[model samples]
Structure formats: structure tokens, C-alpha cells
Target: MNLKIQKISILLFLFSGLSVFSQIKEEQLILDKKREPEVKKIEKKKTSVESIKNYPPEEKSQNPVEYSITNVPALSDFQTSTLQADDISPNLKTDYYSNYVRFGMGNYGKILGDANVSYTLENKLEVGADAHINANHGLQNIYAWDSRQTSLKAGAFLNGYGEKGKYNVTADFGQENYNYYGIYALNPASDVDINQKVNAFRVKGSYDHFSNEYLNNITFKSSFLSDRFGAKENKGALDFNFSKHDLELPLNDVKMNADLGLGLETQSTDFEILNTNSSSYFLGNLSPKVTFIKDKSYLTIGSGFTYLSTNESNLSLDRKANKTYWFPKAELQLAKSDELKFYAGVDGGLSLNSYASMLEKNLYIVSDQRVTPTETKYNVYLGIRGDVDELIKYDVSIGHSKVNDILFYQTNNLFDTSIAAIRNAYDFANTFSAIYDNGTKNEVNASLQYFPRENFNVSGSFHYINYKMENFDNIYNVPTFSAELGAEYTLLNKKLLLGFKGFMASTMVTNLYDVTNTGLSTNYTTTEQLNTKFGGYVDFNLSAEYKIHKNFSIFAIGNNLIGGNYSTLQGYQVLGAQILGGLKVSF
Candidate 1:
């Protein structure tokens, strides 16, 4: 072993396996500090800041999940539930935020791969990589498991920051793979197999201080998720949380804010479908958020508490107590962009699980009688962005929603065959629920732009979506719509850039149990209830560049341009248009 001593013995065996995983996470944090008094009596109790009132000003960026806006972060705590950052759109583009590497091949033999890479320094370190894979087999496949079906995913990320802003750090890693084969028709000569593998990681830190109007903020986030199957045995998730926000009012328009957060999580499960064996469950959530930003208009309210415990094997929980959640979010903005701007927002929440006090619970007890905990929800949104001169621009959005309890699914059972009646005793009660007296969703979006000259261009977009669960059961009530138009033309005088695009989507309302009986432990028949479908497509893109001098120039691309045949879901089918080209150099 003399190749540099075999790379120094693989870097000393990866630093002795990261020092034995940091000494087994410091001996599981010393057994969670000896269960710190039963986790401090189940954590919950916070209120101070002169008994609460004026305190709005902390929002200088924090927490950024890919979507960048000066490095996002700050909704004044509530541990990000979703929504806000006003639909950041810089001419909306997707390649999922490219750092780029893409491969393609089509003409009825579809195959593609995608990649993203990242690195940043000087501004305070960062590292990244993301991947995607696509496969095809439906162009004519007599069989061979419909001729090959697969999906794969990969990921990695890291970040660091410090320089008067105090400190911060982040890390992540991920993986996923899926495959299916069984010549349809009840698995003719079935070889039916299943697989799952996942791993996740996270770490966060924050701190800040200021004087003059008094400001202070603090944060800490932790995460871990893991899964392994092949005979199942490795399944775990552990999370830790922390948050604090303080602001001294009078920064402007009657602003006020106060935020506090607390969190803890745990889960470990062993998997097996056809043989029977299930256990390991424990969940806990505690949240607190507060806000009041009144310039364009803002108001937020919040609350939370949830704790679940399980330890059986088959199932349980019709009532065993502990579950409380309440959330509220509100927003109002009218930038009136010198041209036009508008936005409206809303968030609602209510959850109570004491197994639903249906007169002291227990309607089917055992643990969670297949689960339906309890829920009450709400969501609403409206937006209108601006820009006119300088060659036109626009944005429009509308949304609506409401959902409750919602647990569903009923068949496919994913090859488990109910495990031979689990020792012969029907009604295992693993799936079925219907407290959806409320379930509605609506969405409308629009994007448009035009550039008269300066390189000639045009753009378009339209979308409509609706999902209603009026009365639940065997569900059905979906409506979808999509439209896209594009154009780009840059001449020999400006190098060369020619493009054309067209897209269409439909269903206008359809169902079949959203593409057939849902699986993965079957939930009351779901997957949106057999994805009823409709299709549309049209694409064409071409790029060319020649500066044969200066910063070195030479570019080329031709993608999908009219190879129509659509199916974004429902037996999934995508690929008609295909072509890939690449080459670039710049300094």
C-alpha cells in the first residue's frame, strides 16, 4: 500500500468514521441529560418582554431554503410553516435554481439526468450538489415490467456565515431510489419488489445584538432523519429546536412583534410489509409565533402544542390524550408598484387531539385507530405584481384552501396482502377516515411580459387548479388547467437566440381514485383519487453564440421543441421533445 500510503489509509478511515459518529452523538446527549426532568414537564411555558406588546424590528435575513432573497430568513419565528417572501419572481425560471449539468436523449427512448452544483467563499463558505434522474419505457413495451420504471435522487449541502452578523452554519445530505416491475395485470408472473432508503441531516445557529432601539435575536435548529429497508431495521428521526425574537417598536407604522419557540422530536421504526412487524412511534411539537407589521398591513397570531406516543406493533390510538395546536397568520400589502402592486395573505389552524374528546375519547382505541387525530385548517392568498414600461411585465396569483382530519387510502396495500389477515382477525383498522366536511382548494396564476426590441422577446403563462373534497369518501373533485406560451429571438447581429414554447394541461375535472388505489399502508383510497388526466405540449429552444474572441465565447442548445406527448402524472409519461447541448467558458 504505497500510493501515498493509499491516500493515507483513506484519510485514516474517514477520521475513524467521524470519530465514531462523534461518540455516538455524545452518548445521545448523555441520555438526553438524564431525560431532563421528563423533558421539563413536557416543555411549554414562556412569556416575558414586559408581559408582551410593542416589539417589532428584527428581520435582517435568516433561514434560506434555496429560495434566495438576500439570503432569506425572518418571519419573526414560528419556525417557518410556509408562505411569505412575496412570491419572489425575477421572470420566474426553473431548473430548480441551476448551477447546472443536464443530459438528455429522446425520440421515443427517453432518458435524462440533471444536476446542480454550488460553492461560495469569501462571503463565508458554502458547498452543494443536487441530482435527478428520469427514465422511459412507454413508447412500446410489450412487457419487462412495462419495460423499466425507475426514479433516483441525490443531495448535499453546506453553509457557514460569520462576520459581525454573529454566526451561522448548515449541512445536509439526501438520497432516494424507487423501482417497479410486474407486467401489470395483477403482477403477471410478479416479482413485485419494494425499496426505500433515505438519510437527512441539518444544523443551524444564529445570534445578533444591537443598541439604539434595542434589538436581539437568537436561534438554533437541529435535524436528523434516516431510513433503511431490505428487511427493515434502520429508521430514525430526531430534531431539536430553539428560537427567540426581540424588537423595540417605533421603527415605523405601528409595528409590533414578539416570538418564542420550543421544539423536540423523536421517531424510530422497523419496517416489514408481507411478514408483519410494526412499532416505534413518538412525536412532539411545540410552537409559538407572533407578529404585527403595519406598513402595507400585517398581523399575525399563533399558538401550539402536540405530543404523541406509541409503542404497539400493529396499531392503536383512538384516544390516549395529548394534542393541541393552534396557528394563525395574516398579511396585507399594496406596494402599488409605481405601476401596480397588490398582495393578500391568510393562514389558519386548529388542532385538538386528546383523541378528539368525543366524550372522553375511545371510539376505536388501541392507539390511533388508524389515525385521524383532529384538524381544522384554512389558507387564502391573492397577489398582483408590477412593471410596465421598459417592455412590460406582470404577475398575478389567487389561492384558496381548507382541509380537516383528512386521512385516506384503501388498497393496493403495496403487496402486503394484509399479511394473511394478521393472524386471522379482519378489520385491522389500518386505514379509513372521513372528517373532511371541509376540503377545498383553488389556484389561479398569471405571468406575462414583452420586450419590443432590444433582442426581441415575449413571454406568457396561465394556470388554474382546483380540488374539492365535498363530503369525502371515494373522493373526486379535481380541476386543472395550464397554459404557457413563449418566444425569444435574437439575431445574427446579437449572436443568435431563437426559442418557441407552448404547453397545455387539462382535466377540467376528473377522477378515478386519483390513478388507482393508493398504497404505502393504504390510506382510505388516495393519491388524489386516481389521477384523472389530460395533456398538452409544444416546445422548441435554440441558442447560438460566437464572439470567437473576448472572455472566450461559443454556445449551443436545442431542447424538446415539439416532440409532443404529455403525461406529467398518472402512469407518468414525459419525453417527446429531447436534445441536449452544452459548452461554456467565462472569466
Candidate 2:
């Protein structure tokens, strides 16, 4: 009985402990449920603050430190730095044409034609061909005088460039026909027909090494000329030039340049006459020069050594000569600014003379004539040139020159008078011969230009010369004073162009021969000299052009508008007022 009672008490105690543990767990679960919503609310508030800090501002301020609308670039409007096609201005660009043609006819039976075409390759090589024609039947007032002329020329050229230099080659052929009509106007009683024809062929080539340190340039040329009078001439020349620029000099702020050149020329002429005379000439020249340049000034010191040899079969003469000439060049800018500048220089050179060239200058020259080259010993000049303002500019210069073997035109009186036809023709033909003289000349020249507007420009020049001949009493056929004035105007957006030109010259002296019977015989005659003076006159011309399209245009030109009859040569009277119209096309 005592053991049962003890077991019951132990059971009661165990039950009480289990009930207390259950109460504690239930209270803890209720507290956890109530705090869950508070933790979620704190997480939502933290997310809101982070979003506000990440967003950008809406505007930027003028002050760099502050944000405002002015400082921010608009995202909707964007531009690139490169130029767009739409931004190019058409008026500042010019269109190029690879082919061109021009044709014209005028009063006095004048006709003209010209054409040119060119092609360029991918390698920068270019090739081109061109042709031209000009002919005139006769003047209206001159009746049978028939001042007719025709000239035709055709040429082709090839040009290319390389990494170091450029090169070009050209070939050409030409023909010219002219008639001597001045005799009829000078002597009405004489009747004669004089026709002259010239044919020429030429080839030329040049290579320039602009970047080469040693070899600079080279040139070669060959030409052949023939006339109807059984005269032929062939000429060839070769030239080379070497230069060094920016050479080291002893002085500071000063640069030096040196150049060396060599040239050789050969010419041969044949005249088909009774004697079959032939002449040959060989010439060589070596030139060396050094130049020094500083601020606003330069000085060039040079010397030319020449060797000349000539052989004439008919005269049985073989002549050889050598000469050396020293020429110094200098220029100084008297003013510090470009608006006003004064400069001076001394220069001289040798001039070549040939039958073909002489014939072109004076067609009346005898077919078989003697000729010699001219030498310009020295020329000294001083000049001032500058712009007075944006609208005006002026240049004036004074110079003195000493020359040897200067050519002059004079009439010949050495023809036979036994035959009536020969005498009459020779006496009245008024043909000219070339003569040489040594002399000194003084000259003054002045030029002025005005550009008052963008589309208009006017220019005028005046020249005065004084000649002192050592062997002759006076210099023949040379004008002492001359002047020219020209003006150009553009209108209608450059579609129409107008031009005016005027020229004036002073009087000149010419010689005339008077025939007299010396009572010796009918075949014999005496000639008396009569020095005549020709008064100079002024000439005016006008020209206009209108463009109908970019590729086509029409032009009209009027010559000698003032109608002042004048003679530029001894017995040649110039044409009166004449008009010409033409069309120009390009593609």
C-alpha cells in the first residue's frame, strides 16, 4: 500500500512541468506574427530612396556649376563635324569641259575655226589634241589689193607626273599663206602678184624634277621650216639646269640659292638659188648664278660664257667667237609694308636670230639674206609698284639699256632696172630689208589699274623710249611714245562680258628711194634718198559676249571703231572698221 501512493505523486509532478512548457511556446509564436509587417515596411522605404538618387536632372544651368536648360545639349537635335553635300555652294565651284569648239565669220571675208579635245587616264596621265584655222579673202575698200591670208595649225601633247617630277611632250605642224598687197596701195601704177607660203613642223619635250636635290630640269626641241621660195631651215636645241635651294650661308636669317645651266643650239639653212648658198651655226652657253636673300631684299650674281661658230658656204667664211658676260641682279624693298614698295634690278641676255623667225616678223624680206644674233649687253631698271588703295594700283619704272646688233627695217634699192617689168615691180613693191645697228636706249614706263567694283576693271599703260644709234643718224621704224588703255565689265551674273581697248603711238621715220635718170643709159639709173615721217594715229576696239547656256556662247567684236586709218608698217595700211561674230561651244 505505501509503494502505490509514492508513484501517484510522481505522475502529478511530471504533468505540471509539461503544461508550463506548452504555454511558453504559444506566447513566443504570437509575438513573431505581429512584427512581420514592420520588417517589410522598412525594406520598401529603403528601395524608394535608392530610386530617387539614381535618376538624372531635367535641366542644366547657365552657370557651369548649376543645372539649367541653356547648358544642356538637346538629345533630339544632333550635328556632325563633317560637311554635308547640301551645304556646298554652287557659285564657288567651276565646271570643267574636256572638249571645245569655236567657229566664226566676219566682214572682209574673215573665217575662223578652233577645236580641242583632251582625255585623262586613271594614272594621272593626260593626252590632248587641238586644231585651228583662220582665213581672210580680202578687204572691201582695197579692191584688187587682196590682203588675203590663211593659217592652219594642228598639235598634240602628252603629259604625266611621277613621284619626284613631271614631264610633257608636244608635236605640231602648221601652214600659212599670205599675199603681198601693200604695194598696190603705195604705188597705184605698179601691177604685181607676190605670194608667200610657210610650212613648219616641230617637236618639243621637257622634264622637271621639282623635288630632286641635284638634277632640276631638262629640255629638248627640234623644228623644221620651209617656204615656197625654196628656202628651208632646221633647228635643234638642248638645255639642262641644276639648282640647290635654301643652301647654308654664313649670315643669320639669310638664305642662299645656286643654279648652273648649260645650253646647246644648232641651226642650218639652205637657199635654193644660183649659188645654192647654205649657212650653219653652232652655239653653246654655260651660266652659273648664286643668289642671297634676306628680309625684303635679294641679290643675284651671275656670269654667262658663250661660244659661237658660224660657217657660210657661199661667202667662204668660217667665224668663231667667244664671250663672257657678268650680270648682277638686285632688288630692295624701300618700304616696310607691301602697300608701297620700291625695287630695282640689272639684267641682260643673248637673243637668237634665224631665217624662219625673221620671215615671220617681216614677210617682205629677201629669201636669201644675211643675219646675225643680237646681244643685250646690260639693262638697269628702277621701279616702284604698290596698291594705293583697294580700288587702285600703280607701277612706274625707268630703265637704260645697251644693245649690240639691233635689227631695223629698211627698203632695198639694189634691184636691176633694165627690164620694165622688173624695174616697175621692184621700185613699187615697197619690200623691206633687215639692217643691224648698235645703240643705247632709255625708257620710262608707267601703268595704272582701277577696280572700283567686283565686276569691272580698267587698266592703262604709257611708254616712252629714246634711242641713240652709234652708226646711224636715227633709229628707223621705231616709235618713241606709245600708250594703251583697256577696260572690262561683266554683267548678267557673268553671262555677258563687254570689253573696250584703245591704242596710241607717236610719229616714226621711214626711208623712201626716188629714181633719177643719170643720162648714162636707159639701163642705168640714179637713186635719191627721201626720208619720210609717218604720223601715228589712235585705234579703238570693242567686244561683247552673251552666254545662252553654260556650254554655248555668242560673241561680237568690232575693230578700229574710231575709223582712224593708220599704218603700223612702212607701206601697209590697216583695215577700217570691221565686225566679227562667232559661237563658242564646250562639252
Candidates in order, TM-scores: namely 0.24, 0.77
lDDT of 2 by residue, 289-355 (tens): 8888776566777777777776776545455555554544444446555467787877777767888
Runs in model 1 lying further than 4 Å from the true structure:
1-106, 109-138, 141-338, 341-381, 401-438, 442-452, 458-487, 493-497, 500-567, 576-587
Q: Provide the overall lDDT of each model, using Cα atoms, as 2-decimal numbers.
A: 0.39, 0.62
lDDT of 1 by residue, 306-416 (tens): 566655454332233444455556666666343476768767654323212211111111112222343546678888766666466777889886766643322222223
Tell me how far candidate 1 lies from the true structure as C-alpha RMSD in angstroms.
24.9
Q: How many residue pairs clash in all the candidates, one count each? A: 24, 4
- What is the C-alpha local distance difference test score of candidate 1? 0.39
Assess the local accuracy of residue 57 in candidate 1 as a C-alpha lDDT between 0 and 100: 28
On a 0 to 1 TM-score scale, where does candidate 1 land against the true structure?
A: 0.24
Q: Give RMSD to native, each candidate.
A: 24.9, 35.8
